[model samples]
Each structure stands twice: as C-alpha cells, then as structure tokens.
Target: MNAPTAVTRSQTADAVTVILFGAAALVVTAISTVLRILGTFRDQGIAWSIPIDEQPIDATVDSGAASVEGIAQEAMVFAAGVDPVSTAAIIGSLALWALAPLIVIVCVMVVAWNLLRGRFFVRGNARAFDAIGWTLVLAPVLIVLLENVGLNGVTAAMGLETEGPVHPIEFWSIVPLFATGVAVGLIAAAFRQGIRLQRENAVLEHDTRGLV
Candidate 1:
C-alpha cells in the first residue's frame, strides 16, 4: 500500500485538534458561566443588623437599645463602591464569550482551506492551529477573570469586614488556565517544528529538481 500523503495527515491532525480545542472552549465557557452565577448568588445578600454600643449610665441600667436599619441593596455598587478590576473582568469575559464562536468558525475555515490547498503539512497549518490553541486558552482565562470581578464587586458591596486578605473564589480557575497555557505553548512549539520540516522538504525538492 502507498504511504499516506502529507496533506492527508495534516488534514486529519488539524481536524482532530480543532475539534478538541473547540470542545474545550465550550466546556470552559459553560463551567465559567456556572461559577459566575454561583458567585453572584453567594454575593447577593441584605444587611441583617448593624451593631451599636452605648455606655451604661448606672449599674442597674443596661446599655441603650440597639437600633437597626432595613435597607436593600443590589449585589454590586455601581457608583462609589465599584471595583474597577472586577468591572473590567466582567466586561472582558462577556466580550470573549461573544467572540468565541466566531473564532472557532475562523479556525475551521482556515483548516479547511489548508486541506483543500494541499498545504496541511506546511507552515500555514501549524500557524492556524497555534492560533486556535491560544484562543482556546484565552477564552477560559477571560471567563475566570470575569467571575472573579463579579465576586469581588459583590463582596465589597456587601460591606463585610474581613480580618485579613482572602480570595473570594476557590483556586480551581487557575488549574484550567494553567492547562490552557501549556496546551497553547505546546501547539506553538509544534507549529515551529512544522515550519522547520516544511522548509527542509522544500529544500530537498529543490535539490532533486537540480539533480534531474
């Protein structure tokens, strides 16, 4: 049997990688949305009581009666209490989510174009894969950042005093972000390798032509 063509191999690999990254992006988006909603729920609350203390006038008489106010406030403070970091995160996440499908579509089109042109093993395919990988990685990070922002804003607006610095959400977001980064880096390295191979193949082809 004849060996598979370079173009055929490249097309197969590209299709698999694109599907993998596309699935990953979708999963990350879903998880991030759930986390953000949970964070929002955790942030939403009303002030139960405000403690006020007073000195006692006499031994027999106790301290003055405490007064409490009943006020409802939104989870986020739009004016004075807004956290700029969290605000930016929310905005960035929304933007990323909106653009993710378009990015995927573009990546698919690039892979299809390369396959049709018989350039799957060339530098272009590698570059396209690298781009898709990086975009996938970025999508999750943006989503996590948005969730963090929403949580931070909610916590601040709640007026809860903390003894020390503490992050509102669990550190799981970092895990996926780190994984995505590693994947992107690997894909970039693979692209570089593919470019080198393509250059070498072109040189060999030129040498063969000269020999003939």
Candidate 2:
C-alpha cells in the first residue's frame, strides 16, 4: 500500500548481508564435498555409503567381510572399484548438492536485495521464489534417485547380490523437501498476487515522483 520505510530497507540490507554469509558457508561445504568425491575417484574412498536393509542390525564392516552390530535402522556398505554408472551417479549427486542450495540462496538474495532497494512485489522476485520452491521439490527426489542408481550399480560391479528390489520410492527422502517446497510455493504464489495488486500502484507512484 505504501513505500517501504528507510528502517525497513536498512533491516532488509542487514538480512541480505547475513544471507550472503550463509551462502558463502554453503559454498565452502560444496567445495568440501567435491574434494571428497575427488579423493574417491583417486581410489581413496570418500566414505561413500549406500543403504543396506531396513531391519535393525549390529555390524563392523571391513574390506568385504562385515561383522554386524545394531546402528539404528540403516547399515553401511563399504565399496571400491566403483563402476562407470556409479561414478556418473556420484557426480550427479554432487552437482545436485552444490546447485540446489546455490539456487535457493541466490533467489533469496535477489528478493532481499530488491527489498533493500525499497522495491517489493516485483515479478522477478516471484520467479525467484518459484525457482526456490521447485528446486526444493525436485532436487531431493532426484538426488535419492541418482544415489540409488549408483548403489545398485556399485553392488552389481562388485558381484554382490542384493536382498530385494531397491528402486522403490524413497518416501523418507522426499517428505522433508516436499514439505519445504510446498511452503515456499505458497509464498511464491502470494508474491505473485502481491505483484498483480501493486504493479500499477508502483507505476503511478513512480510517475508522480519522477523516480525510476
């Protein structure tokens, strides 16, 4: 309804700075992940793990022979000589991790920067929110799907027989991201509605003030 106050703009600028710092932290994490993956390709394993079974068990896994111990609901499979499919899958997985957070953060930065400049209800900000929302929904499932492919391929490469089919839907992976994505999507929709209502008002204000 009205222009953002200077106080509001200052707060948004501070928020943008904090968000930039957060994004920087995420970048460091991504770089760390890439380094680990590089070590794996060099035959120094990066502790690349895949799901074993849903049952409770105790295990000590070494080389190939695993001595079982209970460690919650999941178990780890130590693997080497990763297959081409598995390598590709791991690369894809890394890309997803690096890219998803980057996308969401960049979108948030866009919105914050716009608000800091005293512009709200911009269409570009709506698209930013859309990018964030959709990436959240899709990235998690895709990451899991890629990992499963790698897991299966790694097992087959090593001539290990799996207990059952492993390609079923991973609801555990999808749920959290899906929930977050839905929430962001709702926000995106609201942003779009704001744009529809205020774009004309924005135009009139600018025309009256002779401001860009």
lDDT of 2: 0.74
lDDT of 2 by residue, 1-212 (tens): 54554646568768778678867877786887778666555544434555555666565778648686564644445566777777788789888887888888788888877777676777778899899999999999888877777777667655776424445566685898889998999998998888777867767887989964
lDDT of 1 by residue, 39-117 (tens): 4333433211222234333222235455444433322332234466755655566667656655655666676666655
Residue 168 error for model 1, in Å?
A: 9.9
* lDDT per model vs. reference: 0.57, 0.74
Which pairs clash (backbone N, Cα, C closer than 3 Å) in model 2?
57-69, 57-70, 58-68, 58-69, 58-70, 59-68, 59-69, 60-67
Clash pairs, model 1 backbone: 86-149
> What's the residue-level lDDT of 18 in candidate 1?
68
Question: Candidate 2 at residue 9, lDDT?
Answer: 52
Distance (Å) between predicted and true CA of 208, model 1?
3.2
Lowest lDDT 10-mer window, candidate 2?
Answer: 39-48
